[model samples]
Each structure stands twice: as structure tokens, then as C-alpha cells.
Target: MGADREGGARRRPMRAVACAAWGILLLAGCASMPDSGDLRDVESTPRQDTEVRVFAMPPRENAPPAEIVQGFLEALTSDDPQYATARQYLTPTASRRWRPESSTTVLADGWDIEVDRATAHEDSGDYAFTLTGSKVARVDEQQSYTPLDGRYSQSVHLARDKSGQWRIDTPPQGVLMGRSDFQRNYMPVNKYYFASDTAGGTGRPATAVADPVYVRQRVDAMTRVVRSVISGPTRWLDRVVRSSFPTGTALRRDVTALAPDDQNRLTVPLNEKASRVGSERCWEMAAQVLFTVQNLTPTVETVALQRADGSTLCTLGADRARTVATRGPVKRPEYLYFLDDKRRLVRILGGTAGTSVEPVPGGLGEGLQRLSSAAVAWDERTAAGVSNDRKDLYVGSLVQGGTLGNAVLRSDGKTEDDRLTAPSWDARGDLWVADRDPARPRLVVLEQGKGRPVEVTVPGLDGRVDAVRVAADGVRVALLVQHKDGTESLLVGRIERDGRSGERTAVSVLGLRPAAPDMEDVTAMSWAGDSRLVVAGREQGGVQTMRYVQVDGSTPDVPAPAALTGVKSIAASDDERLPLVAYSEADGLVRMSSVAQWQKVVKEGAAPVYPG
Candidate 1:
């Protein structure tokens, strides 16, 4: 019965849990619960009653648990040194998920990791038994918080080594970058996360942990940052360029023409702004993103190219400018900081840098930010790209595997339920899809055909499967599942190539609760570089977060712990390498470890390194 019932819904929903109130008193009823501190291993567990018979507390206003987890995970590989490696965890897209300006003060001063533990309790169907973690804890007085309105509501970050064991890694090595064994995982529709709260005293009045004055001050400061970053968006578009037309060149009647003069002209600002103290020379090309996705109405953000030098090539967005998308563009970039010769940000932008996020009624910091939560992928083989000979960026939504490639953008249907998610390309160029089908959500196989779609199913995924990853070799598949109750589980299964429903051979369990918080479902996932799978979760509220989870190895420890969880929605590459989007609290994304501490912990752990 245990096997047949799939844990009998023993676990609750794996959706992202936002501990917006860190001051959660552990819920008084928790006293009757097991003592996780006892280390008695009573088997950590969350209730499974789908029915809401128990109210954990006064039901204070709070962020979902998923948000907290996602924030923490992104915080792990927080070092700029971890960027390249971490980028692999991101899907290939052209949208930003971070606010460079917000991170400038953060990443510029990166964290050193110190992991305490990275393991899941159990996996019952999609529900995970227990997934808890701890860190060395920080004492950043300026950043530290107390309680707000009798409750604890502070920006949260965790410190843990998803690497499991410790080891030294190059930028690329930080993630599963350039792994020869893995396949190139891709998703077209870029996902993003937003941290700005629309929760203006919504629902019931919630409590805060930080002193109301301090919290208000911090919020006001962030508000100023937001205002500063966005002010340039409109001004840059109007004053910077139009006012910089060369001398008297007859300005095209089509483009807004303003003659450049000492009075109103602008320069790269050869000031000490981003100049290094002692560097002899600096190369500055694409000083500004010629045009941003918001200009063209981007579904996701593919921003930034961190150079070998400490300096980074990033997109700079301004909110004051016209939000110019197809219908209406958004006016924010996830991260706001940029690196100078000294690896410091001279200017910071605002907006999400994620690849799978939906622009929720967002715009110029005010308007519905539209997102094409498609989660599709293209490679050297698909039409989504220019050619195998060219470097082209294509964005697509998830389509049923059966309808994959066959239709450039065709999904079974865009009804309330049939939306594409986690679309990936296989070696054979066929599309293997993880159907979000509520009735019978199975792995749908889609190949290029002439007239109509020929649908097939994978018997292995007969129940609630969240996300699926096909190994680089195309012989294996990793499954991220969320049982009905809200638990999480991971399983690696062998894929049979028979014409009939492929047979599945279970290898070993990777993690039971890899994507908690946003565990309701995994919206985006891919093989990052070699040894890891970049996975993203869809929160119960429809938002998702990204995760760089470890893949199985030759040993008992198959699926390892998740890097981040608990956010609205996110997307990542397989090995946790390429980052279409970095983590940001403003976007509701989580960073388990603080940038400074995560780097430190991994070093101390001298942890075992996984091979690509």
C-alpha cells in the first residue's frame, strides 16, 4: 500500500513557503511537534492533510516558504567568482532576473560560504518528508534584524553547500559548465521573479521583526534606490541619446533628433566613475544595452556577460523611460550593480534577471508586467535559432512534447490549464515534454511530423510529476515530482527507446524535497553543465523560483540537496552553470546562503567536488 499509494499523501504541498516573518514563533502547536534540534531524527515531516483542518498560527501575513528557499539557494553561489559556474544553472535566454543595483552592494562584497548540512528527509510521491538547513549565521548589525509588529519579517538568506561535499572550482566549475557527459538543456520562454510587494496591507495586518523605524528606513532606502534606478530609464531614452546626435548630421525624421551641443550633449563621462585607480586602459564597448527587452517587450531577460576580469558586462535599465514592449514593457532589471576595474558598480539597474519569470502587471515600475511563462528551449538544431553557424537568441513557451518543434509556437491549447513548461531539446532533436496535464500528467513525447501531432506517453510518469530532465547522454531522465499534498521528491529513471511507452528503470533517489516552497511544481529545469540539473519551481500563487540541484552520481547519494527554493517562479540550466537570472529578494527570489558566507563555507567544507 505504501508503494501503491505513493506515500499516501503523507507530505503536504511542496509549493514555495515564504517565511516573510522569520519571527515565526515555530507555531505554539509546534511544541507538541518533534524537536528538530534534538537531533533524535524523529523523522522531520509536515502535515499531509490536504484539507485545512489545522491553522499553524494567527495566520499572519507572510511570504510563501518557497520564496524563502529560493532566496537562500541563489545566495549560495553568491560570489562573483561563482557567476560563470552558477550561470550554467540558468537557462539560455536574454532577460535579466536580478537588480544589478541592489546586488552591487551585495555581490561587490561577496559572501564566503559555510555549509551546515544539505540533505532531505524522505520522498513520498511528490511530497518531501522534511527539508531543513542551518548556517554559521551572520552578525551584520546593519543587515541583522529583530522583529516587526510582534512578528519577524526580514529579507531571508540561507548558507549551505549544494555541492554537498566541498572542493575548489573555477568560475565555470562552480556550476556544471562545459560538462562533456551532459546534454545542452534549453528552454525558450524565459522566467523571472519580482520582490516588490503588491501586498500593501493586503489580507490581515501582518507583523514585522525589524524595528518598525529601521524597517521603514530600509524600505524607504530601497524605495529611493528603485526611484533612482527607474528615473534614468525614461531620462536615458529621451535626454541621453536624442540629445547626443553628432553635430549637424541631418537627423533622420524617423528618429527623435536633438542636436548635440556643450549645453545638452553627453559623454561616456570619462570621470573617475567606473575608472580603476591604477589601470592603464579600459575597454568599454556596448557601454549601455543598445536596446533592452522591455524596449521590445521581452518575456525574460538574458542580461550580462561577466568577463574574465573582475569587471562585468551587464544590462543597465532605467524605469523612467517609456515601457516599450509589444503591448507594454516592464521597467526593471533584477540586479542593479555593475563591476568596474575595481570590481565595483559605478551604476546599478533595477529589474529581474530571470529566464522563466512572468512579468506580472509590471511596467516602468508601474503597470501590468507581462511575461510569456512559456519555458521553451532551442539549440543548434531547432528553428528557434538562426543556424548552427550563427549565435541567435530565441524565446518560446512550453508546448506539449507531442506538439514540439512540429509547430514553431504551437501548444496543445492555451486554455486555463494547457500552458507549455520545461520544454527541452534532445540529442535526436525530438522533444520530450512533461505534460502539465491535470488528469494524466505523463511525459509526452513530441517529434517533428508532417500534418498533425503523434502523441506518446511515458508510463513511468503516470502521476504528479513536476519537472523532467533528460541526461546529456539521452539514456537517463531525472524527475522532480510534487505529490498532491505539497511534498517534493526526485527520482532518476532509465529511458527505454522502444516505440511503445518507454520503460523506466529506477536508479536511486536523488532528493525527496529538492524544490520545496515552490514545490507545487517545477516550471523550468535543464542539465546545467555536467553533474547538476538547474531546476525552477512554480509557487502555489503561480510564481516560480530557480534551483541548481545536483544530479545522480555512481554512488548511493543520487539526487543531492537543492541550491535554492521558495519563490514565485524561476528557471535555470542543468549543471547550475549559466545564469539567465541571479537571485534577488526584490523579485521574490531567495538566496539560501549569503553571498559572503556561502563562499566561505564551501571553502571550509573542502567539500567533495562533482565532475562534469
Candidate 2:
């Protein structure tokens, strides 16, 4: 369900005095501007770490049709909680019928409003205006954001009411605003769920997957997020993730506010539907709440689930939550691995400086099998490497005497560029690599890094897969697809495995969507967090740049990492504390330091990677 549905029925109103005070301050600021000066460009204020409350002005008495329309658009961008002021611009019936939370249409710029001449007739007491702009994205009812590239045009109708005041009669169904306003009004938060294939209470830890969604920054956010958790994962991720909350679960009807206590413990009150779950299931439910809530605020260290009758269902703390469900890789990698000057696998401690690079303890690292690129497994005990020729893939252990096995997979492409790409490991120990052979491109995975390769079916692939990086959760894969126009775009797809037992399980990548749609060429990318990626690419007609993007295709609120030139391959650990390692054409292997500056790691190296 989308936020604020049912006409913001669940939303609480902001204090009237607070809204009035903010209005006075806004007017005062506008009144204080200099009357005359040479016009200078004013830089936009940086996004605030704390919420910025905005209260839009209501329509003036006897306002004109254009003024009414303009007022409504501005009000949509305010933090008015229930958006009561925005509704004041509409007729009584329209206000009652409008569903502002149905969805949000974000345009590249604020919409252009112009009178629709054919439909605007002063004598008829009616006016029609069209809203036009370049649509950049849309947040659906489930709060799943999707990048869009197209024109947006919507018509709104207004008429004079009995009070001789202009009011909108046919307002747009959902809220609409520009990208800047959208950013100011919403913030992304991750809701946690266990992988559909894993069960929580088992001996093995259930893998937690992040399902990101946007919510109003300060509008009873904790309560809204809790409700979203009860509503379940967004539609796009529903098939691959499962929420522990029972079917029809929801917050008790009268429960509208949720806050952590002084000790940073939050108690969620659920409806009767969740009152009868088993203790194990309730703990899983609490674990889900803990993980989800912690992302909103690190201070929330524990979550206690309570039934509608005010009885505790289960209480799970952050420490215990980790054991019940793991997010991304369970362990931080001891060292970052890469191909050294000798084309052999080598390693350096993750967060230390002045550390000497040393060969890994294995045949692949013994300078015997020259490697083009490599991926260390989740446990750091095993590694997969692509031969220097890019035609063969080898897997070996990190033990001192371990020998590299014969090629487990081979590409018969005619040239190095057309052969296998670099390999990536997932949390499940499965290895993924794509063969870029033009005649027969294939995305294949090796179960446990052994046995016959299982070709992954990509249903809507329109180009050759140039690179593959499976996220540590093992449910999403990032692919660099080369199009016919010679441009490469980064796309993310969901990994779906059929419910068949044994080695013959069916696997396919579905719902492939552009993760970096604005980029004309995505040269390199890596998963930098649970649902964020560090991407190096260039926009159309723009210079190459590095930025962080969420899996849902939205840019992160934080600033981009320190800039670097000619980045060829980038690698990052889900543990963001570790430095980012990248291979640059101009600087060889380098890593970002604690100061956010890129420092040379070695005079010569390539394909730097941390354990998956």
C-alpha cells in the first residue's frame, strides 16, 4: 500500500502553531532580500541531515484560476503531514475524492502550467490547464521507484464556486512535483525481509534482503515505516523476499505514533492478525523490525513486538538480530585482493596504510596462472579467477599448498574482449560470470563453484552482457549490457530460482531494469552497501564521474565519493567503513583513504576486489 492512502487518514496533523511560525519565517526571509543588485547565481542549499519542515500557504480568498493551480502545486511539496493545505485549493468534492498518495510523478523540472485554450471559457465559469514536463521517475503505490524517460502531460480543471472563489475540480489523481521537490519531500528507508528460500529459526542464519522505499521525512515517519513493514515487501521484490509478519497483519487502528524509549528500545503494537503467531515466527518478526528500524536510526538497538492486547509477542535486540538474520556478507574481508604487477593474485589489509602487497597462498597466487581479474569468495577461503587470456575460469583455495583446479568454465570466443568477463561470488557460494561472445552470449553460474555451468535465462535482455556482479544477498545481479550503439548501460535483475530440489534447479534473471539509466556508458560498478552501489560512468555528452545509486535507481542523498579519473574497474565491500578500491587507467590500482582522497595502492595492479 502506498503512503497516505485513504486521504491521509493515518497521517497526523502538524501543530498549527508550528506551521504558522514557519510561514512567518518564510515571509520574513523573502522580505529581507535586497531590493537591487547585479543578479548572481545562488547555489542550492545542501540537503539537511535533519528534517526541514515547510508549510505552504493556503489559497487566498477569491484567488484566480492560475493562482489556485500554482498554490496547489507548491503545497504538494510541503511537509504538511496530512497535506491539508494542499486540499484547500480544491472543491469540497474534489478534496474528498483526491488520492494524493496513490503515487508520485517526479519531473526533471517543476511542471509548466498553461491554460488549455480549447477547454478554458470564462463564460462557462470553468478553466483548464495542462501540466507538462520531462518525467524522470515514478514512485508507485507500493513505493517502488522506477526510472522513466518520457514526456509528462496532465490536465487539471477548475471552476468558480458559490463563494465566487476559484477551486480545482479535477485535480491530478496523485501528487506531482519536480526532482528537487521530490528529494526535499522524501527519503529512502530500507525495509528488511528474509530470503524466500531461507527459514529463520533453522540452524543456518536466514539471509536478510533490503527492500528500499521512500517515505515523508518527518511525517510520523516511524509509524509509516512500521506500517510499511507490516504491508510486506514492495511488489518488485515480493517474489524473492518474505516478511515474517502474518497475512493481514497491520498496526492496531488507533496506533499512530511509534518512538524508541530512552534506552533506544522500540515497541511495535500489531493488530489481532499477528496476535496468534508462534514464538519462533514472532522472533523472526521482531528481527525484521529490528533490522528495518535500525536503518532509520542507529540508536534503535532493540525492537519488541506487542500484540493488540498489549502483550509482548517477542523482543529481539540488535545483537541477537544479527544471528537470526544476516545482511550482505557475514564477515568483513581481512584483505582486498587484486592482480599485481606480475599478473598474479595478491592481497593487502583492508583499512591499513603502508601495508606491503603479498601473493595469496594458492597456486593462482603463485605467479603460475596469470590472471586478468579475480573475485574472493565470501569466506575468503576460496577465490575465482579469469585467466589472463580471458578464456578460462579457475577456482582455488587460499591455503599455502592449495593447487589451482583446471578450468571449470571456458569461453570459445575468438578474442580476449569477446571471451569471459570477471567472476563474482554471492553469499551462497555460487559464482557468476558472463561470456560476451557476440555469437552466443551467456550468463552462467556455477553451483558451489563446481559442476556443470548453469546458463541463466535473461528474459528481456536486449544487449550482450559485458559484465556481471552478483550482490552479496544472492538475490540480485548487476550486469553491464553493451548495446548496438556501442554504449554500455548498467542494469540490475532479480535472480529467481525454481523450487526444484538438487542440482537441476532452474534459475533465471527477471525484471531487468536500468540501474544507471542516466548514464550513457557505465564502465564499472560495485555493490557498496546493502542496497547501494558505487558506479563509475558518464552521462550523455558528459565527462565520466563516480556516484552512488540505490538499487531502486534513485541517487543517494549523500555526496559522491572523492572524484577520480579514468576508473576502469571498481570494487567495494558492503561494509562501507572499508576503503573503496578501484583500478584506474591513469593511476593503476588505488584506494580511497580515511580522508576521502584516492591514494595509490600499488604502482601496477588491476581488478581490485573485496570478498563478496
Candidate 3:
């Protein structure tokens, strides 16, 4: 929300080959070499200008029923004011009753539009066609989108008018479009909600979760974003987060626009039903609005809630709204921690003036050996690691006099790829891991550093999990899975824990769903912000690219840094504003700071990571 801009000018090709690579990431094999020599001198391909919203062409006169239907569907994707041209294809009564803004179903490319002429009667002057395609996302009545399965079929009915001109008789209420049209016509916007609860240990206030949804790029986007937040969280995340807006909340009558005042404080008018709530509830709702608006438009620094008469109910500033919802560990250390050349854990203080890196003054740093990948607990007292051989998984103390313990979990040492993935720590101090060992391919959740590992049941999980990352809330686990066909994808599942009070002894995964279903060949992933992740992998069969994707699989329009080609690993703070750190073949260990430029942070470093 700071200087970070979403959806810059990065352009994806309109060709089928380009989309095919992005849709499933069908890679023949992984690339072993770097793609770019100088990260600073590289320039991304220029994007085509897609800002022109209104279409120049209108419905042709005396068009047949099929052509009229086609013209209407295409016209719906334009930015024409009031859709005056599109309405010409519909009967007067149908046009009056139809609302294109009701909902939107985003479909995949290459959909077949078939007109059924088999049943047509010569005298009836009526025709029907079918639209069939795989869906990517569905924007519902309130405009909240859920990224679940998108296989859809809709029938369009057209009839001739009294004047003998073809017009839509029973057009669907909402709109539908293919992915390419969606990309060029719509834009992704995030609606803010609160985390389910405060951070467990430190009592940090609940943080805001940004739910990414798409809306018309130039048409009433602000209105759509606000309305969706008021409606509630999307279907996929309803159980994971909370919203302050009341159940029956709505915008006040006669208020059709949202604009910032000269002072940059945006005033929002809610219906009288919302004004009936108590002051505390009102403030919370105000925080939700403040956070949501600020993300969409950065110039808004404050938010004022008001009623129909325009009398301000409450005024909230940006500073207080920023920390309303927290994610990740309760207490993040001042330094970014990673494994050093000596095979020990080290820290590089964040925001420190000079670039001096130092190792932890403890047994964990001195006693550990042959370390390849490591993760520090939120408390910063415990550390977990996998041996360079990927055979052993260990958890130990990070303090001065503490000992480096032996492996709590081990993998089949048959091959390097069969070894365990680097461990992940949850807010409850639970350690999570997955073994690619085909003989024992399974996910385990260990209680801190002791007890038997609990095997999580993943229903319909078609492949072996390669890496696992648990969210700070301890309810979600992000996994990178390799399918039977050798293609990889990023999936997130709910960790079903058993225990309301005391220590939880049982854990399992349910509803395993792909976080980025369309993206394949996912190599690395880490929690970047609340309900968001920075994924590193190739959408195409080439060098890996990095982008910040929503946990629900929706990618924001914001411009992410250029792809760190040949990147082996990457790490980021739960707070989005913090600099991102990563290890790559080209740069060794590098960091992106305030200027958002990548620079070397350490000459010899590997497996960089952050706390839970």
C-alpha cells in the first residue's frame, strides 16, 4: 500500500501458445542456467495499450439473431457509458429488466460458441446458442469473486421484433467473457477484511486480509470494490476471515460515487442500518473501509464515515488503520535470518544503516553442521533445518548455551530429491514438513520439537508435495506439489487441528485446493503478506518468475519485481513493506530495499528464510 504499485505495464502475449504456458506451465524440464546477465539493465517487453474502454463499433443494422447476440456479448466488455449501444440488441422490456452488473463469469480461452440451427422453425423467427468453456473465477452479485472451479454453460435466446429486427428475448442477467477479454477489460482490486483473531502469543491486533477480485478496469471500479467489501468475504475465504460491515449494510440512496476531499480524507456514506450499530462496531467498520480504499487509491490518507445528511459519524486516520490486522509471527526479529557459508544461522538487521551480517551467538550457530535449509520460530528461540543431504530434519535452540539437537524427522536417503523439504513453523510452534520420498510421500505436523508426527490426510491430492509453508494463523498450509505428469503447482489447504484449549495433539489437512491452479512448475513459495504469497516459478517452460499471488490463487494487477531467473530460494517478511531476500545462481544472496532494486546482501549465502 506504500509505494508498491500493482499491475504495472508487464504484458503477457495474446497468442494461444503464450496462454497455454501460463494456464498450466507444461515444462519439459527445469532450466539449469541463468537467463539474464545484468538484473539492473534488463527491460521487460512493452505492454499493449488496453486502456481504451469504449468500443468504436456498434450493433449493425438489420443484423441476424446470431450476429445480434454476438455483438451484444462483445459490447458488454466495453466501457461505453450506460451501455447504450449494447441495449440496442435487446428488446425494450428485456433491456430494462436486464442488469449487466449483476455478476461476471470469467472463462478460459478458446471457448466454443455454437448456434443450434437444428431445431429452428422457419416461421418462429427464434434462435438459441450455447456458450461452453472452463471458468477461472466468478464475480457474484455483490462483485465478490471466488477462484473455485470455472466450468460453465449458458444458453442465449434471441427472437425477432415486430419491426423484423433481431433482438435478445431471454438474455442472461449477468455477463460472461473469455480470459483474454477479461485481462484487457477488467482489473484486479483487493477488498480488505480482518484476520479471524489476534496473534496467539503476542496479542497483536488482528490484521487486514486483502481479498483480490476483478472489476471493470475503468467503469465504476471504486463502487464495485466498496460494495464487495460490504457484502462480505468471498466464498473461499468466508470461514477464514471476518468483516466489520453488517449483514444488511449497503450504500446510502442518492450516493453513487466515492471521491477524496481536498484533505485526502475519503468520506463514505452507508445506509441507516449501519449507523444503527454501536461506536466500537462503527470504528471497526470504518477501519475496514479505510484499509480497502487506501489500497485501491494511495492518495486517500484518512476515512470519514457519514450518514445521509452528510454529518460525520467518525473519522479514522491511516496510521491507526495500518496495523489493524497482523499476520505471521507475533514478534519478528529486527534481522532477516538465513543460513551462512559456515552452515550456520545468521542475522542481518533490517533497516540497519550499514550492511554488516552477523551469526547468532549461540550453540545453534556453532554446533550445527552440514545445514542446507533452516526456519526460525516466531519466538526466535527455536530453529529447524534439513541436512545438506536432505536426509535429516532437526530442531534446536538458538540461544547462547543451548545445544543443537538431533533430527526429529528423517527422510529416505535413497536420493537427494527424495529427502525432506525445509521445515516450516506455525504460530503455535508446530513444525510442518513433507517428504518427496515416493515410498513414504506424506505430510507431517510435529508438535514443537517433540511427540510423534501427525500425518495429514489430503483427499484428491493427485501428486507428491514438494514443499510446505504454514500460515501464521496456524489454520492454512501452502504446498508446492509435483503432479504425476512431472508438472508442479502451488496448493493451499486448511490444517484441521484438534483442541480448543491446552496443547493440540492432532492435526490433518482438509479441502486441499490449488492456490494458483493455472500456474505450474512452482519451485518456491513464502507468506509475503496476510492472505498473500510471493510465488517463484515459471508459468511457462523457461526461467522462473516471481509474483505476489493471493492465497486464493488470484494475482493482483500490481507490478512485481522482474523475474529472478535461476532463483533457488526466496524469503520475505509477513509485512509487505519489508525488503524481500532471495538466493539465486546469478546474484548469490541479494535483497530489494526502499528503492525496490535488487542488490547483493551477502556474498555467500543459501536457503534464506524468515520466522513463522
Candidate 4:
């Protein structure tokens, strides 16, 4: 090679080259290497003396306390027709919770926000403050703000982004309403507790059977609830009753008690004379505790959650359900009830049922697997209820999978009208179920339970919900709601608590462009990175994908129509991660950073479409 190099054009000798690349992460003032991507730098201890606590200042002192207080009032009232505020100061995340489909929930003017003092306790780029004010609903005490009427002092938790501007973690969770009872209140022995079943509609209603509210109350309140920690599984109930209860104003000697030892038995009986059915409680998913007997078939039972304890919590009785059912061939012996944490009954679901009933499991697959397979056959016979009283109504929950999460698909009735639309969950963890009704339309939020689902309400947008999405944190949610008179859109809101009431705030509304006419609804929405949402489902194999950043209703900054080329399933990556799109038609999964990068993945080969 040396001789050849003398005559021919010799290539330069390739040397062993070791390349080194370094990244620097800057925090405070010092720079250090971090694992990568938007994780807010985690730095090692400093070499010298500096106290972070000393520098911490409350929200009002560091910045104008007035602006912080005003911003919240403005955002809160933005939805009110009387107090329509502009959308300038909202951050992208804040705007997501501020989407309003209907009117914004407001605190009537009678409630004055006279900020007594804003003491900035601490600041680490993020801010925290303690706020006190006198908030009163209108003296008239109407439905608008009837529940909250009084003065209160509350802790205000706020956060600041890289921009150094402070914002509330959520105005809803921190706000306090004195009049409302539970959902927040709890202690050693308090009558008030969290409630669920409200105004019926959890399942079917109970017949005119005696209400168990009094009985369950006696159980939770009169019975001394001893700690299971010292003992195990609740055996302590016997000891607690023998030693602590029985004397003074405690339990009456005449009344019989549920033996602690009875818990081990498959079926334990409650004293019919002493115990009554409690109101039934429902969750957003599946849940039902049977009220067939005063005694529950040995299972761990607690009082159902309600708005507040001691307050009138309505639960459905199984027999009541048959009477209320729009269709009948009413069967009794129904079994199901929701009890409060105090072991008081909340509601009755399916009463002691006839032989036709079956136990509903928590997971989707477990439910479907339980079917005898004959339920599908149109043929009727004398076998396992397949012929006449089919199990379809009870089975098709479209439940979330056991661990990974999946949905059960079942129709309530033999006819098509009774079948539930396929249930699904979006990028944000909020549950999205297809609507069955057109006019008084309803899309139920199913909370998982051992027996039946607990239906919870999403305020602001009611019924006709085309799609709903919970944020990465199941706490925040967005919805694609359908309206009468032919209107549809993206409605974003967050769950806030005013004392006991579950309040929702509408942050923004998404308007579909006529240019993309064929797209009927925004079936899937993923908040890619910060301000952009990668909207899917416009055309068929046509796979229309668009990214939108909201500025206002008039002008949302959208990239060129072709920003995303032939996109399919899209997933927004978390901090330090690149958003991914599944173009199954081309490859399978395509990774990208921004609009430009996503365009590159599409240009190379399109991903296949996800099953609609």
C-alpha cells in the first residue's frame, strides 16, 4: 500500500477518531448535565452556603397580589354572560381548562372576593400563597349559588412555568364553600361524608320500598367504628362493640349486632329489625353493592360516598328499578347497593334477583368470558336465561381491561335500541362512550365496580357528548360535544371543588373548519407538546391530520393544511419525548418532533390507519 501510494492517488490514512459530545443544563445560574428533555432540571447540592427557603416569598409580595387575584376572578367569570373576560393572559394549559361549551360557572356578585391578605410563603420559580376572603351566594339563596353562602379562609396552591408567571394549580380544588358538607370533610366520627348517587339515574330506580337511609345512618353513626390496624380484616368490630359501645348513649342492648366473626362466612346477615337499606351510590365506572338482604353476602362493605353524610343521599332499590324501568318483565330478588365509608347503605342496584342474574366482574374480559356463549343465539330455550331473560343487558359494560384497561361490549336489551355504543378512552384518561340518544341524549361516565357501573356527571356540557378526554392526569378533561341545531366542538374543563360540589370550568371551544368539510367530528385529540393538538379523523384512507394552536375563535394558528401528510394514529409524547404517529399504511409508528418533523415521517412512508 505504501508503494502504491507513491504512484496512485493514495487515500489519507484513516485515524482512530473518538468523538465526544456534551450537553449543558442551566438551572438558577449554574449549568449541569441532566438526563434530558423538559424535566425541570434536578441538580446536585451546591458547594457553598445558600438557603432556598430564605428566598421564598408569597404570591402577593413578589408580584402584584391584585393581578393574581384578579386573573382568577376573571378566568372564573369568563364563562358568565354578565362577566365575559377576554382570553389574553391564559397560558396554553390554562386555556385547555377554560374551554366553555355552555356558559361558564360563576360565583354570584353577592359573593365578594375581598382578599384580606396574600402572604407569599415560598417560591422556587413556582409560587404559593395563603388567601382569605368572604364569599357569599346571593342572599336570595337561589340555585345559582345556593350551596355556598359564608366566609372562609383557604390555602391557594399556585405554580409558575419557565416564563416566571404564576398560575393556580386549579382554582377548583383549593376553593372552599362553607355551606356544602362533605367531599372534603372527614374525621374520627363525623356525620358528613362524600356522596355519589344524586337525583337517581345511577342505574334504574328502586320501587316504593322503605328507604334505608335511617337504618344505614344508625349503623355508621351508632356503631363504634374501631380501627382494624390493631386486629385484622374487621374482627375488632366485636371487641369494639363489647367494650366501647353498649354503654352510655352507645348502641342499645336490645338491638342485635353483626358479629365480627360473621365476616368469614360466605353470607352474613344483618339484623332486619336493626338495619335498613342505605341509599345506593354510583361511580363513573362499574360499582354496585347489593341491598337484597339487610346482611351482605360476606364481602368487605363500607358506606357509599355521597355529597355529604347525614345529608339526604338517594340510592336506588332493586325493586324500585323494576317499577321505574321503561320496559318490564320485572324480576325481583335484585342485588346491589352502595354504602358510605362508614358502612351505611347508599343505594340498591339489583335486588335479590331470580335465577336469571349473574355476577358482573370488574374487568372487560372477565365479563365477556363469563358468558355461556348461548346468549348470542337468537334461539330461545329453557336453558340459562339465554332464551327469554338474556344476560346481554347486564354483561355489555364495555369495561376497562383489568390492568392494562379494555372495555366490555354489551347491549342492555335484545333489540338494537338497547345496545350501548362501543366505549373508548382518549389520550387524556377521561372515559368516552358513544351517545345512544339523539334529543335528550346521554353519554354516561362509567366508574368501575365489582357488580355494576356508577354513573358520574360531567358538568357544563350535558348529554350529546360525541367524545370526552381526560388529561394525562385523569383529573383534567376535554370533550367533543354535540349540540342541537347542528353544532359540534372541543370543550375543555377541569374538576373543581367548591366545598362539596363538583364544579367544572370550560376553558376553550374548538371550531371545525369548513375547508375540511367531510370530518363530522373530532374523534381523537392529542395535545402534542404544549399548545398544539394533533386532531385525527377527517377523511377515510384520506387520513386527515391537522395541528391547531388556539389564539381565539377567529384565528387559530394552524400550519399549512399539509403540515401532516397521510397521518394515522397519533400519540403526544411527554416531556423530553417526541410525539409519535402510527401510519400503519406506510410503516407502523413514525416519530417526529414538530410539524416539520411529522411531515418528514409522512413523506417517507405513511403509517397505517388505526381501526376506527
Model 2: residues with Cα > 4 Å off, grouped in runs: 1-51, 499-503
Residue 99 displacement (Å), model 3: 5.5
**Separate clash counts for every candidate:** 181, 0, 12, 79
lDDT of 1 at 81: 24
Candidate that scores best on lDDT: 2
Which tens-of-lDDT digit does each residue in 1-612 have in candidate 3?
A: 112111221111111111223456332211111222211211211222453334523556676554566567666655664677678888898899988777887766523455656534436887776656677776776555557565676776777889888788788667776666676667666676766644322435665566666767676677767877888877656766778777888888877888888999888898876776665566677777777777678788888888756777777787765455443456655667788888887887765434687887665577356787888888888888788888988787877787766678889849989879888998778888898898889988888766778777787788898899888766678988888888888888766555663565456677666677656677778888756788887776556688888776677656887657678888888766568888888888888867777888878888888787
Worst 10 residues of 2 by lDDT: 2-11
Task: Give the per-residue Cα lDDT of candidate 3 at 423.
Answer: 87
> 86, model 4: CA deviation in Å?
20
- Number of the top-ranking candidate, with TM-score as the measure: 2
Model 3 — TM-score against the truth?
0.80
User: What are the TM-scores, per candidate, against the unseen true structure?
Assistant: 0.28, 0.92, 0.80, 0.27
Specify the poorest-scoring 10-residue window by lDDT in model 4. Answer: 376-385
Compared with the true structure, all predictions reach lDDT values of: 0.27, 0.83, 0.70, 0.29
Q: Which sections of candidate 1 miss by over 4 Å?
A: 1-371, 374-378, 381-418, 449-456, 460-462, 484-488, 499-525, 535-548, 553-577, 580-585, 588-612
Residue-level lDDT tens digits of model 1 in 341-426? 22111112222222232211111111121222222222321212111111111222222231122233233333434334344444
- TM-score ranking from best candidate downward: 2, 3, 1, 4
Q: Which of the two, 1 or 3, has more TM-score?
A: 3
